[model samples]
Target chain A: MSVLDRRRGEIGLGDVASALRSLRPADADDVASIAGVLGFGLRAADLNAQPAPTPAIYDHQRPLTPQRPQQTPSHERLPGWAMPPLLPAPEPLPDDVLPSQIFRESPLAGGGEERPAWLGEAYRLLPQERATPLRHALLPARTARGVLVAALATWRTGSEIDVTELTRLLAEQRMPQRLPSLPVATLERGCQLLLDFSDSMVPWWEDLRELAQQAIAVLGDDLVSAYEFAGTPAEAQRWDVERERLVAWRPEAERPILVATDFGIRGTPSLRHGGAEWRAFVARCVSVGAPLLFFVPWSRGYWPSHLGLHPQIVHWHPATSAAMLRRQRGLSRRVAR
Target chain B: MSHYTPRNFTLPADYCFRGDPRDPAESAADPYIFSREAVIAVDVALATGRPLLVAGPPGCGKSRLAETMAAVLRWNFVYQTITSRTRLEQLTVEVDHLRRLNDAHLAARSTSPHALADRDEEYYHPGIFWWAFDAHSARRRGLPESVARPRSEPRFPGVERKPPDEAREGTVLLLDEIDKAEPDLPNDLLEPLDRGSFGLPDGRTLRAQDGAQRLTVITTNRERELPPAFVRRCVTLLLAEPAREALVAIAAVRAPQAEKTLVEKVADRIEALRQELDESGRRPPGTSEFLDAVNTCQQLRIAVDSPDWEETWQQIELVTLRKPMVTEDERSRPA
Candidate 1:
């Protein structure tokens, strides 16, 4: 049979050969030229019906919409936001207590009864007297995934915390459930709760702030830090001003950590400005050595004991998760050694 | 477009690669989102012509991104959707029975010793990969058919006198939902992706354009990580959930008639639900769920805030959060 009838399916060696033979000399030359570039060529068709031309692989598609300009939400527009004024900053913790503390915790200190029952036994076996809280929670990595693991630690710290376990805990805590059902109002409520907690009603907030400052001292200005907040437009504006102030004072060499506090209910979704603006906040933190943290309400169910950032993220852990606490103790011991 | 036949399968028209479709109010203000990250990823894949792995929770727009890539490249995108049952032979052409019969007849009638000597070589049928390969080869040769015919055609248009040895320059191949396939399925692509040729079970290897061929994009839902050996052959891109406002903007575009507040509310709810699932160690709902959920609400004319439709609305939410898995589980369960 001729090459045409010898062809298999709509496309085959015989069909290709026949089509190539049928092509005009120019077409054949074109194929030859392309083949030359690709280091191959089509076999010439024996019969005269022109071979089908090869399809073009790359075609132009309509360009996506250009990125929106960076918007700085007005202070009035920010939702229930508030920012600590840029003043004489309190001294952060010693270097031993910062990122280095991640490795010092007790791996065998804690476990959730349902998720991980081993921690209870581990806590019992440990020499440390303060092992009660350590027995209940797992490390962030042992429980969470994604951004939540890293983000969670910044939200709440257990009696003992490890930084790297944040992402896993956040992932475990926020996945499929909290994120999908989270309401805008609820987010706002969470932010309000955070701000309200700081109003001196809760001794825990003060103690936590002191510990945070101590940790910040240990890590230095280069530590990457992240925070999550909820609030109304007014609160968002307050945060905007505070964030701007922090950016203005930040040294060029010491990058600022990302502070992912909400702007308002209706303001910019993601806003970045300056090497220090709210937008580039996360990247700046990465440049430094801090873990980004978020502050939300206990009720929001998103208090990730950890948050996961990019590969470069240095997660912080809290006392809530047992695994993190144990790791923290281990690291502390190592530093003492 | 005319050369391809009308097929029952087509991607949704209003597909957006980023953000939520169920909520509009929050998203309307920033309706246009140019994902520099995603765009750069597509560019990198095109430049290197390497397979891309996109992983994320559901509704992160992994599949839509593939479609968007096809559109942007202006290529005749062909998605070879795979399931658990898919085999390598299905992608590689199997031996054709009709061709085998013709070969046998010819073998019996062959009077010449030379023709009879090669009887075993003629028993194969050209498979889909070969069809795509040959068609791509013809198009690179500047054949008129390549420009006009989409991939849906029954017969790849235009016959030639000989098989073309040249490979096409820019054909785009989308391996959709590859996670649904066997875990080892990715290994099947290693040789073809790297060498530009696939070996058949019969021992014949088909080479497209000798080595230069189409751009291949593989998508996964991150159900499991592929073996490192296979992953080394590809560039990886991880997709994250967009913020609520971004989703709202997408919703406005897809559901223009819906009230903005209503859209925002829905998006918020969906986001909350997803996070909750994540927190609970459950798989979050995907972008498809968000779209279908909104469509369901619209069809029933139910207000998102109304308490009367709470049960139905919750069901819709659950459906989105747990799709094919729950459905399949239900089917397999004993009554």
Candidate 2:
């Protein structure tokens, strides 16, 4: 598996599979192969060595010009001159002789199956559906949980390594003034899950709940601060675990915020979540150094243009994965020039 | 460029991956049966310098291949299971700032002679890459012989997975579940894996002393896509799910104590269950589940044509093969 072999996605099977060379017929007898491919039935030469021989389909085929099989339609067919003439016009009977127009009954009328009494309700009622775990889900719960973890989780410095202060101390030969910094990927700073519960998001209400659960599952129950808001995300209120009451969502420095919203796509104009509010929320998060991620149910084209580039937006879809998220965030390695 | 075969790297026909005995006495499984394709893949990876990327559904024996290779070769094994939080620095080298600070404090106090004699090299914590590349250098923590070694030795990954007390030929490094890490991790790994060296913060390079003897085997559940660049640097192998015949053969090796009839029955059931699950868009049970079913039947004295066969098999199927991901909302769904 050399670099070029992998790069081109081809292997040199010809070098190893000697049987392939044996497949070639002796003395350039490739006409059979070509004939077979071209749908030309085998010639007498192809079956020369066979003990039992069968005629090819073409050998049994009849001519396109009139032949025995087709002679009936070609010769016995009726001509225009020999065809029967049109029927004479029917004579109209006297008014008294025929039954009155209104009195004559239509034979087709009143001949039908009786509509059953229960049929109406049956038509109105839906069929009893069996439960399915995967049907109509934004993503598989397991993969969703992983993606949520990958997208929302932020890294914090480990307690150990404070290289700058250490370097200063080592150079200047002074007492320690700061803690050492050993940066380890962690969710210690926690995350704020802002779920959109507005009218537009009604269809995905269950999905919103699932998303909340996924976020909490990834970033522990204690660390995740979930909030619910209708129109504007910035005006969200969360049930504060400490206060035992709902509190307005405030950006905490170093804490990441994950928003799962549709940007009020299907709601009334008045109920739509304003882009300005999202922009403000993102601005506030940026000001406080809180990372923000938006998991939108809509495709990129349907997303609001005004949200700006600050909040990383992810497609809330089953196909959306950590690799796609990395590409979006410009975190993946430099791929192509 | 030479032709490699099973003859070059054949396991002792009885080499199986059995579970360790617990407090309660339980019958052990038979030897692991090696697939020809898997063996060929290992040989190719060994011949080539590129890392071997093994991918399959869970318990399809992805990681076991690496361990088997390690055991066969009698190499130093170092493995690391990746999580969402795994980073490139964790796999390479990291500076111990606290230790450096402690050393500085002790040197100032003039009480600890160990701290006084310590150099910048003593503060470096060599990660698995350093250990696999050159154990001697990692042991010394990149310090010269004149400098005293660090008080604590660097920790090696997969110490338990390493075969016990044998002359080591080379290293077999296993990075298990690289897919579990964030997407950037694969990309971050490309340079270090390509060069077999990683850069230190103090502008020094820790590299592989001898490249040919070392084998890097990375496994994935394919939970997510890895960077193409990272994949390009690997000899990729996708282990196909085994067939009915394969299942039976695996059972023969994995559950040697079980009767052939019993193993065949379980294999037949597994084959049916695999089709059923695949048709339903669910992941089918792999070899581990197969062994569990056969072992369960053997221990409980369940025969192929036993009384209440259907009912007993149904119960076993529910516990072993059928693992449906049912949410509370979907609990009422018909199976």
Candidate 3:
């Protein structure tokens, strides 16, 4: 047991109060005032002798007895199915940490004015063979640099930069203008630097880890980022197990497994179903771990605010996807622990 | 300085190759050498402007074929010897100390109030590909671009000596042993090869703009696959070892004094040995090897029937072989 717990166990509440009362002044003028307040010759020990109040008990049977017969409506205002009880006023959500504070602290956010970040960092561990195809795809498109810069910023700030804002910044930078017609080793190196910094420093953010798992569900474990899980020491041990499960459980290769959220009714009007069913689906998503988020549909209200009201649900952006978030979350847990 | 100038080479009056480019019929004495048909096919490709990738085993005369093309076309021969250290700038001119000094001198001379100095012209040594394009254009057109001088404006003043019109007329650029160039070097050629134009370091482009075409012949040992982008741009032709008759023709060329019986015997034996190697999936000696053996006998003055022929043959074989000898164990493995 802790020191505070043990010490508090030995002291009685009355004794502590009595001791506190005794510490008060015994000045000549205060004696009359003390007498007036305490009555006659009441001692500090007597003040401390008061008993604690007893809590009231609630009767379970009292609410069941119905007594209002005078206001009986004709045929109970037409027989009808009872409406579900209204939900209690929701507790206000805890204010999220400010984006500015998050951005300032995160190492993923890069500094162009300063020295290049991730210069000395080890990139996120991935299979070396992937460097080629990734380069091939990324080089010709010239989108790799922007994605990498954002990833670097993600590492720098240790927070998720709003992808929209990041994309905007990249457009303004016109990074592609200065680059070779085809991105080459320089682009590859930039990507490596970003991965290295993120892997060594920020690791996976919580939302991203959850998304990764959901992604794994939709895209098979053969996907490049799937192997990223093996980088962490703890996850490394589970790599084989997870890999084997995924391979065995992988859906038909011809068909992509769709993993979008219901967000209440917006995703499918016909599949409205029950709130209980939604809760169950959410629980399954949490257990499945990656990428799956339970959300209230836009039909109910828009995104973060809608998802935020439900303590059990999370907002999964369409672009970010749930499976990726799960894997990132998994990575984040490994980093945090 | 030399007697032969840009106008010395002229297209042969009788162009036989164009008439029958695909015919497999060979030169009567040497079937192993390219049939006149093959030569014509290459010529047609050249005329139509195609970059030919000559691929074959080592010593199959792929490199020599380019030399022959240069000769036949009567174009100036320019060679770039590539090594591991070869880089992008080596293939294209970049800012160097010489260029910088020239720039500084031009800036100073143009601005100085105390009468401008007539400075020595800067001769930017052009790369093999660029130089061929530039020099060839200059020779055919007579320095039209070179004659038009800029006024040496205060901002971005013109240098006294223009970049060398190193572009030679009808230069057949032979990129020999192209496999040796660094990975990214070939990709750099795409622009110049595609458009027949390249930009200079000074933000000016030198074009073969309706000038004599620069014939480019690239030879490779097929060490590795070139990038698909580069490969797609070239006319690919693969060459194999020449036949026994071709070998004899090659021998006759190399050793004119050697008896016909000796030459035939050597050719037959070499052909048999090469067949055995091929059946066993082993690398065989090239036509160069056969020529080497014949040259050795001629040099040593040994009779073909002499008992010492075997001993002398072994000694000659060692020097003649370019590729590593395939061991029996390696030959036994399925290709």
Which number leads on DockQ? 2
Q: Candidate 2, residues A34-56: lDDT per residue as tens digits?
A: 22211233421211011111110
Once superposed on the true structure, which residue ranges of model 2 sit more than 4 Å away at CA? A1-337, B1-30, B100-117, B147-150, B159-168, B308-312, B324-330, B333-335
Give per-residue lDDT, candidate 1, residue A7.
22
lDDT of 2 by residue, B1-335 (tens): 22223333455444344433321132222245666446555655554455778877788888877776766665667888987777788788877766676777898898876674446777778778887888888888788788776677776565423333753458888999886775567778876677677888688877678643688889877645455556655656666678888888787766678999988888888888887655433567888898898999899888888888779988898788885445435543322
Best model per TM-score: 2
Give all candidates' CA lDDT scores.
0.41, 0.63, 0.41
Query: What's the candidate order when arranged by decreasing lDDT?
Result: 2, 3, 1
For candidate 2, give the DockQ: 0.06
- Candidate with maximal lDDT: 2
Once fitted onto the true fold, the runs of candidate 1 whose alpha carbons sit more than 4 angstroms away are: A1-337, B1-34, B97-128, B136-169, B200-205, B210-213, B305-312, B318-335
Ranking by TM-score: 2, 3, 1
Candidates 2 and 3 compared: the better one by TM-score is 2
TM-score, candidate number 2: 0.55
My TM-score estimates for the predictions, one after another, are 0.39, 0.55, 0.40
